[model samples]
Target: MRCEIPILLRCCFCFPLRYGLLVWAYLKQISSISFSTVMIIKLCHDYYRIQASGAVISSLIILLMILDIAFNVLFIISAHKKDYKKMRIFYRYSIAVLCLNVAIVGFCIAMYAYYVYVAPIMIIFIWSFMVPTLVMIIVMVFLQGYLIILVRSEFIKLKNNSQFEFVNHGADEKCTANLDFVKEIPGTV
Candidate 1:
């Protein structure tokens, strides 16, 4: 009965349920305009004005989103089977990827802000273009490394806990057997 609760919770958190919510939210955000159309236009405009290669970045962002959606769906299904270990790994990976997406979005927003405030004619060719691009690249690389470390640490902890549980259970069984043997050896005390 005690173990059943965790299993129930795990089932509830499965991929389809979680991914369905994500798909709904994404649809809501893009209900007014097509996602692809906006993405293409934004990429082209950024490429022309800032001389930043926006197409590749934009495509990468889209691809990440698709992967996230698919993983969430898979997670929901996996959880239903009480696969907590896999669920944990899936969530950790999702979080790492989500952090990367956030960094990319932040970089884009920062660039947009710079362009809007700084006079384009004065800074566009040099500072506006090169500075943001360099900064974004550096920050993205650093953040990606950081997220990878975080995920690895989490995996290690999970593995350690499982090992500890296995050892503890074995010890308990051995102790119980010893106690039963002592009981059977009556009058030895």
Candidate 2:
């Protein structure tokens, strides 16, 4: 049998709006702020040696991040309102932002590879960070696909059951779908 804790935690964590907000916070704090600050510091210390226009690229990345944050906030609001059509549109926008982020990460990786193989220049910061960035980007792309699948399944469930009942397991195995005493998310109950 599947562990109840994992299932409960997964269900809670898979709540799309909350997940979007968590991702937004991470991107704002770690990727946009800390990462950019360190890169800027590196550029300032080695302006002549690092000739890859790091400042311009970082600015573009920051702009993309800002767009992503805006999309995520809009998605959270739509989800909260239980407006299916609006949620779908905002989710698509989030997916597009993820695609752009993946592209930017890929470009950064390619630049690192070029510096290593073609240019014979060793930018320590770029080389050091590219690996982790690539891995995270790949994971984010997969997550985007997973979220799409989950949303599609939820749509089907909503269509088949007009009541939109959702079961919440709390210290019990019995399905709560039809239980009047069981509380659930507003739109799904």
Candidate 3:
């Protein structure tokens, strides 16, 4: 049996079931909305650290967060309806989001590298302005990766604990599927 993570909060604080996943989804949705809003507002004010071009970058980040919210909503619906397959869709979506987060962090690091090597900027300016933003994105990427693991654990637990009816996918040579007999007859004979 696959080892399961019982709790989402620091690995040992919360419900032992998929409820942790429900809390995780809600927390992610709220944080994404609030963080995106705060980033937009900050971008508007901090014209030195972030310029008009930063608006486009921040918009792209916001768009990704919005997509995350949509997936969380779908996850909520799936869990409420006990649709484990749809829940698995959210698992796959989380993996994709983690990849996106990694890409964003890589792009940000590359931009910093360009500022350092290709066109040297004031060390103080880059350190004071760009460093914080890069750090924030990197932290988000790590958090996303951690959440992916937590969600995966929950999925594994669900798959293991749940009962499923097994079906034979073989050729119905005797048309056993079509048989609707009035009496219980031995099909083997």
Candidate 4:
């Protein structure tokens, strides 16, 4: 996660590496591209935001997305400062994202069922609606689930590495050895 390798670091680099690329893509597109131009890269991302704006989990999804941006920044800073301990904040939200993505998958399956029931024959209108949405949701579900697993594995690995102080006295140690302590972060929330 950091150059020259900070003292504290991720046991599984893929989590941060994946999100780093996502954050970079978000920044690059949002800064330099017009909405129309951005669509080429952000097709599914924009579709999720716009289409799900009124869905039941929209608020949570929006909150998680916004929070993810913030967390990615935090991860960058913490990684630079050699504070993997602080990165533990992602443990909860990663699971939430995974669950929400599964919910979306369920909703898409239901949508498909209704569409097939209404029209056993091919329908362009519903095809247009279902194909992209289903594809996007399915992809998100897999990605989110893998991310959840990666985050959990990283935290579990952290639990024993005393170099990061992941182990502490009188701790519950459920998921992350009860990551109940946070070293103060400079210019961080």
Candidate 5:
């Protein structure tokens, strides 16, 4: 049971699940916006602007998240192919994505926190959803850090082993073709 815990945690923190949850969270927020909510936005000048801005901002953020998810999927493919350079690039990009997300979510949370005091009703839709999503993202970022370390170590190990094997077996002349290119050239011969 103790040994199974890490595997369980890994599954929970996997890219598919994380990406799905993020999509679900965003969709939930979008779906909750009803006709009444639109009417309220039109009734109040301040809310109309805020709602429009938030809508645009969230849409951009969601697009970024989708791109991040696509990059992660590519990263997984590169890892499987043992392409170390691609893995490095993709992994670095993943970290950048995570940082950008942290910044975006943190800023939104701070805004929500301020609004919580200033306008409780204004924050109602976001507080419960965004808070938990932020926590999950934070956890995923940490998990990704650990995964990056593991990938780096594995890549290094694989590289060294390949080098060692090459040094041991790659030097045997008998194991390779004995024909010299110079001798094989008809005119030169």
Candidate 6:
């Protein structure tokens, strides 16, 4: 089923067995560069300094992605199971949480962008590596929540529409059946 694919991908992302292999490749590439080359030296220095933290952030993002995927899978399954009432409630809560997340991400990104581009004239700490990393982490967190909410809301809307259609169809069928029965009866008039 289409729902199961997301779950499998979620498991893979959570464990990150594939990501580990990608990191290993990057490490090998770094190691292969000759140290005697000046460009290689600069590259190695920047790579080691920035990429150490980047790896941690990337791992966290991947984990959150897995969670997002899992939530989507669950939402799809729940909707398919005819759990419309619960799905609607879940969707409303998800929207609220996602809106909060979007606000936080927007604030963090704005602050970080200003710090990077404009804050140098006004503040010293804003330029620090830690601030940017923290902002990035917050952004990733918000993004994951936002994605989950989007998927859940979409599924909820679709399921609700389908439920309405099903009910309407049943009613139409019953009406037609009643008309057929009435016609078949002996005329008393």
Per-structure clash totals for the candidates: 4, 0, 0, 1, 0, 0
lDDT of 3 at 161: 58
Best by lDDT: 3
TM-score of each: 0.35, 0.48, 0.64, 0.51, 0.47, 0.33
Which is better, 5 or 6, measured by TM-score? 5
Alpha-carbon RMSD, each predicted model: 12.7, 17.0, 9.5, 18.9, 11.8, 15.4
Cα displacement (Å) at residue 110, model 6 = 4.3
Poorest stretch of ten by lDDT in candidate 1: 4-13
lDDT of each: 0.53, 0.59, 0.74, 0.57, 0.57, 0.50
> If both were scored by lDDT, which would come out higher, candidate 3 or candidate 5?
3
Which structure is stronger by lDDT: 2 or 6? 2
Tell me the spans in candidate 2 whose CA falls farther than 4 Å from its real position.
Answer: 1-59, 119-126, 155-189
lDDT string for model 3 (1-189, tens) is 898645343333546546766777788779878997887787677857776787778878778777877888998887677676877899899788778778877887887887788767555577886778778878878877777777666666566657657777675456536656677666885
Compared with the true structure, what per-residue lDDT tens digits does model 5 show for residues 32-135?
44433554454454544567677666555555545655565555555556666766676577577667767867886788788888888977777788778878
- What TM-score would you give candidate 5 relative to the actual structure? 0.47
Q: Write the per-residue lDDT of candidate 4 for residues 1-189, one digit (tens) a residue.
A: 765413223323543643543454356335433433443445445555666545434445445455666665665554345454755776576677678778877887887787688876755677887888889888877766555555455444445553554556557545635555669756856
* lDDT by residue (tens digit), candidate 6, 1-189: 355213122212453322332343244334333322444345456665667677566555445544444444444455456455545655665566567566766776677677667656544665575567666767756655544544454454556567664245565654334334555668788
Model 6 pairs in collision: none
**What's model 2's overall lDDT?**
0.59
lDDT of 2 by residue, 52-104 (tens): 67667765665665665566555556445545665567657756766776787
| Per-residue error (Å), model 1, residue 26 | 12
Pairs with steric clashes in candidate 5: none
Q: Judging by TM-score, tell me the better candidate of 3 and 5.
A: 3
Clashing pairs in 2: none
Best prediction by TM-score = 3
